[model samples]
Target chain A: MRLILRQRELVADAWRYAGEEAGADAPLIATLAELRTDPERHLARRGALGVRLTPVDRVEELATHLPRLALVACEFPGPGEGRGYSQGRLLRERYGFAGELRAVGAGVKQDLVFHLARCGFDALELAPGEDPAAAVRAWQRYEVGYQPGAAQVVLRRQRFFAATPPA
Target chain B: MYQYDELDQALVDARVAEFRDQTRRHLAGELSEEEFRPLRLRNGLYIQRHAPMLRIAIPYGLLSARQLHTLAAVARRYDRGYGHFTTRQNLQLNWPRLEDVPEILAQLATVQMHSIQTSGNCIRNVTADHLAGVAADEVDDPRPYCEIIRQWSSVHPEFTYLPRKFKIAVTGSPADRAASEVHDVGLHLVRDAQGQLGFTVLVGGGLGRMPIIGQVIREFLPVADLLSYLEAILRIYNRQGRRDNIHRARIKVLVKALGIERFRDLVEAEWQENRPHHVQLPQAEVERVRAFFRPQPYEILADLPAPAGNARLQAWYRYNTHAHKVPGYRAVFVSLKAHGEVPGDMSAEQMDALAEIARRYSFGLVRVTHTQNLLLADVRQRDLEALWRELEALRLATPNIGTLTDMIACPGLDFCSLANAGTLDVARQIQQRFDDLDYLYDLGEIEIKMSGCMNACGHHHVGHIGILGVDKHGEEWYQITLGGSASGVTALGEVIGPSVRKNEVAATIERIVEVYRGVRADGERFLDTVRRLGIKPFKEQAYAPHPAAA
Candidate 1:
């Protein structure tokens, strides 16, 4: 049982990632490789389905299976590894993923929580020893952003620089 | 010159508070140095050879007098008594304590300044032409577009942790004073066939171990599509660039490996996909930012005659001043490369004095040039003599701009951890050897750019006479290159011969220049001579055994 920031709340993670022993009743986050190896087998799994993505994994491979997937976990391998950000954006904006999007792996430090959320990750599985409270606080650090992000924090402020287009 | 509105102010303030907490966490041992390095670097804090260096962004090199004063005060209060202006048009405080940076950033924010994305693998400070608004042969000012890009790139979630650092440079004038051709992405402000404003986009140009000139990706990109198009390019580079190796990670390497056509196709596809999702840059916002750069309220005075003065005054007026687009104004260069001083290093006292002088003469504004000089971009022509006297008293009027001694050098082994050798001493050697102004005038516009390593912080690859310091076993050696220019005909310099001893660098330059003097046609600059006669003549003279040794 690990504490995770889900939609800006501290919650116990129920989804088990790769290399973890779990029962068939446990909601499992399978690897993209596993899904690609036996697509029909993994997609037809009982309970809620999820798929884990690495930095090099193509999100388009899971495009057709988005409706069946309930969780998409993008893994960051190490520092300065950013390909997962694009994966998160593609899963949300391009593929219109409706399930939970989680940022997980060694690079998921508290400092990156806001950026991960902005890239549309609703759940952040932060790195080991990172303060969960601080990770949750990072989401509300800035109430504004220059771009129209997927999980943008600002709700009331003017999103665009100009209220209306010039005449 | 753009003023920060409430939203901009709020963002910077929040950033300061966020960094404060990050610093607290690190100091409390909750964050390790390995985890904090990238975090601190993105905020412009670097653990240098001696101490932490905090680089404060002077966006596009424009600074208000108030901001300049605040920088001076910060330098006086926090670290050493001086600061170094980098080649990227940012100021680096060499000796700030890590514990004091958060407060330093707080002090800077009071005057609408921050160090966001100044370093690390993110979009660096967006640079534009130093003479943005006042250059005589100009199109639209590039600063507004630079500001727009700056806002978009600051803390940008997707692109902050790219494969490597990204730089974007914009130039409005056709002269290309900003060296946009050598940047990661270069934007040239241009008018389309229909009189609409747009950009001639160039991609993949960078200076490092493998220097390459950027290729034109778009003939004309409409003004409205700037951000979306840039986002497309960044997304392509981030997802596809080589991340295994640091040396091969720049966008230039990606462009070379994939070829510009394939890269452009990918970027075009990505741009099309992201265009509808992006908040389009509005015409009102463009006008809003452009309004900040409008012409100053100039007096109704006619052009004054050149003042009757001594030879030094005549030379200062000739070399240190540029033509302003307005009738009665001139852009003045405050020479930071004075003889016997480190290039681009300014004292706090000098900063305070210059701020006062700028307030008096240049509409309370100052600009930093890529060549490591401060500029008063809107000085009155009538105030030339008085300004010259004030600058001369402060040793800021060296009257050697665009000369061989007016070199660009980085903080080499003396301060930088990545440097292979020291550059300031070599810069001093060259300055002392070529002390004769008459000979420098005779040489005419030879850019001697020196870098301590191949990281190319000083942009040595594009200099007419490029000097790169090499670590030979334990001693320092110098490699010389010829005929690189960052202007309209942008090209990389070719190495002349094997590296010389560190002491022989100045002599090598002397031999090269003597050869140039002998073979140069009438009115030919050193670069023109090197281009016409080739590096063979200079190489023969430069590597020739010294007469003293013989």
Candidate 2:
């Protein structure tokens, strides 16, 4: 897996993540399973702790430990599943989790990149061999959006005020 | 017709660019077909049996002369020189290449048109009565509301993908010309005792393998609460509606599974929580939309001289012209279901000619009817003879607007990938067998809907004489249904008996008509007769094996 964090590739040696699942070489990072099962023990020793949440995981439950966490990852089970999107947005706009939020799943493809970012994922963990550069242009597909969410002001509200007079 | 403002133009143009890049990524192998299928379908590109069919949205069935010309140009440039008008008042090109779809969409965007949300799980095109603004019995024009929904549902973030496709239809008149009751959501524009306009919301009426009528969810919802209320229902359906099986994924199925009472309670809960802080649609916004649909500049004058007693013109006058709200104006229907031609199919040249006539006679506006016909909304009564003659030259003057010859049929095996039998040929055979105009006129207002399969795109379940094609051991056979209607009082037809061979289908319809002619009371319609007497009389002979059956 490769991470595009804050519009930059997450290159090795900047931060070595040691986990059998990630096979990463980071010096100190809590594995996803440890963070979920034995959170107190892992919280005692970790420098930077991150937990991966599936579509079923409650973001508010993870918010209980928001002070101890630096990153929270959400996974898309498949292309058809959109629950992860709502999870991501609530973590930012509702719960105010200002830490790094990453989207990790096989279904993370170029078509969903624009929407993924708008729904508030600061980092996108693409599957192996996927190009991070191809999706960099997708976030600018539209200068405007319809529904209210994490990124742009909803167009309806914008129009309502725009249609208002100079006063 | 509504004019596009800067916001609307920007939105459509931006969508075109976005879809173009999506298509490019798909072709470049960056996006897998499985990942790209829903995206393309939402843009109305369908891979048909032979080629890609692009369905262009005719929002609320309203089109201007310039847009019609653009459509004709699209037909000539990217496809064969013809387009099919569907029962939903949209247009479909049957033979556009997959690679040319992006250019086709860009061309459509120039006319303030694109195939956005025209297909797929998103709210499909919002349809309204063909005779909406000009109808004499209408309480309020429904197009403004339809436009509000079009903008709300277009590229709607959460609902772009759903369990199944959703449809909505609105009707302003008491006559129910939009077939609202058979849609996923039916909105009937009604006025309260206080004389304020509101809507009667009907949920979950649909036709497919499961044919059901929508139930009234609310008696009267204020026009301001429309968007918020719709969002509530959609949110519930999107989250809880069945996704395990595609067959049972429509909102109608969910509405049925949980009784309408339970569904209404759930929707009410969502609405109550979301209502106070919902999207604020002020009176200015409502009036802003309503202003666009105000009555066009029409002149008041005395009625014109009737095209004086010419029998053919008189027949055309009786069948084709409808009473308009204005004294000197009338609505004229151009039947695309002429004999020897495929129903709902119009050539590019014919479309161009209609555009010219729409400019000259009817204020440059055209409307597509749910019955798969076209209408000129504000035609002058004085121009009836001249327009009829012009249409006759185009072979569009088929004086069978509501008669048996004016059948509604899906593309069937001819173009649709899902069709099981050839419906266009069956429709042609029936038209040939029943070509007598006088006899058809006597039969009086029969709707014969045909579908190739149980998907019911042909709306076979609601026709007066519904013919459903079935595959019997690899042979084409059709089942006959009687007494269905899509009118003011909507009802589904009942299957008479066993299926009949394809060769006997037309003759069976003729025999059923004979039965209606024999026993019907004076001034009774075919559907009324079937309803009163039940299907036994028609069933006795309709299912009997004909000597010619293979």
Say which candidate scores most in lDDT.
1
In model 1, the Cα lDDT at residue B212 comes to: 92
lDDT per residue, candidate 2, B431-491, as tens digits?
A: 9999999999999999999999999999999999999988888888898899899888999
Q: Where does candidate 1 chain A have its weakest 10-residue lDDT segment?
A: A158-167
Error of 2 at A95 (Å): 5.8
Each candidate's lDDT (Cα)?
Answer: 0.89, 0.83
lDDT of 1 at B179: 92
lDDT of each residue in B285-343, candidate 1, tens digit only: 89999999998998776777766759999899889998888888889999999999999
- TM-score of chain A for the candidates in order shown: 0.89, 0.76
DockQ of every candidate:
0.46, 0.22
TM-score of model 1 vs. true structure: 0.97
**Which residue pairs collide in model 1, if any?**
none
The complex in candidate 1 yields a DockQ of 0.46
Candidate 1: chain B TM-score equals 0.99
- Error of model 1, residue A163, in angstroms: 14
Best by DockQ: 1
